[model samples]
Target: MISIPICSKGCPTGMLSQFLLSRILENYPQVITNKNVFTLLQNEEFYFNCYQIASILKPVKELTNILEARNANLADCFIGLIKLGAKINQIQPGNQWKSIIIFNYNRRLGEFINNINILAYWLHPLYRGFGLKQIALNKIYETASILWHDLGNSEESCLNLLMEMRYWKRKVVPYDLSFNSIQETPMKWWLSINVQENETDQLQELALLLFSIVPSQAVCERNFSMLKWFLGERRTNLTLLKIESMAKIRSYYISNTDKEIHFRNKNLSEDELRKSIDKSVVTYDIFENEILERNENLEQENLNRSEENTEDENISSTILNINQFVNLTLPEFLSTGNNLFESITNRSNINERNERGNMEYNPISLAQRILNEENN
Candidate 1:
């Protein structure tokens, strides 16, 4: 696959090509017997086509590899996609091969990449729609505005947030947008910039949200695999809480460097130690017992509360019935009887029946009435 781009040109511009030609000549002379066929292998145009294909696809392949990584999150791929798109756009025109390359490249891009992903790419600290044409920048800003508005912010507020972010990027950040060092991850980088200092709370929040999102489900799929391994045949009946705890513990150990200690243990083989430790770490009876105890306490509390509520309801019912009996008589004049009834109803603190399903124009009731008339 690595050799694909240089297939026609070969290493010395002739290495692999020469080897394949030699093999054909030695063992399959009849395959290329035609004069045209023989000349085609040596054709510069054919080699250039292969090179063009290779060059154009290389970045796409790299982006796929990055997204498929188990631990990779959105920030990595967002940066990568933006860079790849820029590189694709930079392909020189006026050349026939360049046009073909651009068209094929764009067609593939359109098939997979959508505006949402592009918006995410453009929002990155490294890009922030900088260096992009005004049209592209406006599109990115429009999409971002829609996203923020969808998340419950008003359109005006969303636009204001974008404007604030642009200001922060241009004026607040000490480093250039194209900073290549990138010593920290996107989240860490934004976090290091004190949220209170530059009034960057909103911008930092956006960056963290974007950074936390993953481009692919690879991390999720990997975690699922871990789940399967931990909850083997023996632990199939693990409760949701237990499973959650175990997963968190496993993930913590993995990220905290403690899990790597096993690798450094020379005396015990990894498999042998893992088998011995599995019972203690994986079974985790203490956590299960604590969780069970906590649940029991909560259930007891809920039962007591329900009993108290029932007693209160009994007292309230008695009081309500007596009050209703007293208020059932007609007014002396009968002129303001409606107001009297309203006062009595308002004074009673009873829960109302849900009337939503019994609307005046209920279709279900109308259908039932029609069916009854038909049957009659």
Candidate 2:
């Protein structure tokens, strides 16, 4: 017989809800359908599709086998999902059979984070909805299988594995705190000890949620509290850049935002950097160019003296090596500082200004953009 749906008390109106109503008709054909579908749903919530009945049956057996593999049970999955604030009535597909997701307190601080967390708290579907439903079913099956293997034995071996799995799962589950009585306390205490010993970033995060009921419920609010001083309570028209800047500033302080601009102009241009290192041994110093004629005369006299009598060959070799050592070590020795980049940039800027002053051409054009840009 063809299946049709009428409105129900529980599911007021929705396509999927109607689809479920139709499914009820197909399952229990004996049930009178001319009445409103809501009446039928109120009478009974479950419906079976006879044609696909065998398909559902085969997996239950497989699920039984998996549960026996480990000492785990439906109750354990139930408890796990319950701690995550998921309702019992979910019927969709996959792990989403329970919609609840376990996120850390820090993760739920965003506005959208609260929305998602709220949605996760709703009822589960009968079957997992996505393509991965079968896979999640298999995983849960595997989890159950492993659970049974260790459930009765209590050999400490299986129990330990189960405990560890539970521990890991609890950590992954968002908003779940029931398992904390078992392991969460000690883990937190140990963490506090670490925090006391050394003030690390993780400690800072934990400190934010020491007494929190939900993940970062107050964190976003607290962050925005500062901005409230600058903005109205109802203001929602902020530009993205300003909002982002405020967020970054709140998160990391001033050092992060100014770091780029601080380095941009402060850094020496490639041309200036290359010219600073006098690569040409034969090049004349600009200041010394006026003395070139006078130096040439002096050099001729010195050459005559050198041709007549020269120093030892060993002495010349030693002088050459010493010059190389000075060339290399002098640059290195001059560069040492707490922040090499800042120091170098400062020095470069000063030298550049000096160079601009000494240039024979127009100072405006000769000066580096960094200095002249501000001037202009």
Candidate 3:
């Protein structure tokens, strides 16, 4: 239910009213339906007395049964004004007589609302009671026309108008008036149509559309909001896959929730990336007799430099591992196989000798430190 502050009043703006109406319709369809909307007629006095938009309505209907309506006093008159609306054709001085109202204490009253609504064209406020019933009704027909263009009965639906007042007893003042001449031209101009604007149906349809969106997404969003509430400014340690999994799980159980994850892993890690990239580096050589025979010179120099055939073991291990990494860690790079980490971390090369006081630690940082110290 849309709870509004009970204070000095007026109908809210169109967009805000539309939004509120949608929310209400979404949550409470059965609460307010076509049948009950007319129940508003039970309180017409509020409409005529307090409705400020009387300026726009041209004040066609008189406040007849004032003694009968609750809260009919002028202090809360605006509330009644909100209950009613019509198209303004022009502004007449003040014949504000009742032509018709839909519900009646008796048949006389129902006929009264309908007639005044019909003659509503004659009652215009001098300033802007400009849009009368025909224009108002035509607005509805025009909108419905968008939805029901296939119905195919366009000609007879035009607004047929006439001038029918005696000179001495004329109700027309200085408001804009329409005549039968409008329908003479066969064009589809809105003013030319006799349709009266009744927006409740259109508004109801729109409300239905808005409500059709599921509660599940909203629940998901709320859950996400709660999750974010638990986590603070610090970056979370979850990988994208884990975070996504959590989001999916929340959606599966909840309705009308939302999640707000902050961190996105986009950049590559500094330690693993190598500058000189070549596709061939990742490709595995099967350690065939031919490669061993072909690189005899390179193998001899390697053996002379380090008594540990460990270097060759490391090289062999590196080649074997690269093929594995290409196949397993990143099959996409299998074509190029030029990854640097795979090239450098050879099986034999991975061993560490503690040059400092006989400590044999697996020092991954040793090579860089030694090279830097020697250079410095």
What TM-score do all the candidates reach, one by one?
Answer: 0.45, 0.17, 0.15
How many backbone collisions does model 2 have? 37
**Tens digit per residue, CA lDDT, model 2, 19-73:** 6656765777566556665464544333322212323333334333332332222
Candidate 2: stretches off by over 4 Å: 1-34, 37-42, 46-187, 192-215, 219-241, 244-376
- lDDT per residue, candidate 1, 1-376, as tens digits? 1131254324434336555665676667777778887887766676655564555466666667767754455545534544454444444443355644444444354454554655554555544544444444445545555555445544344444565545664555432344322354445555555445524344455555655665577667878888877864343588889989988986676465445665545676656655666765665467776777788889999998986775554432211111111121223212221111100001112222222221223232332343344337
Better of 1 and 3 by lDDT: 1
Q: Write down the TM-score for model 2.
A: 0.17
lDDT of every model, 2 decimals: 0.50, 0.32, 0.30
Residue 323, model 1: lDDT of 19
Top candidate by lDDT: 1
lDDT at 60 for candidate 3?
A: 27
Where does candidate 1 have its weakest 10-residue lDDT segment? 339-348
Measured with C-alpha atoms, the lDDT of residue 71 in candidate 1 is 40
Query: By summed lDDT, which 10 consecutive residues of candidate 3 come out lowest?
Result: 338-347
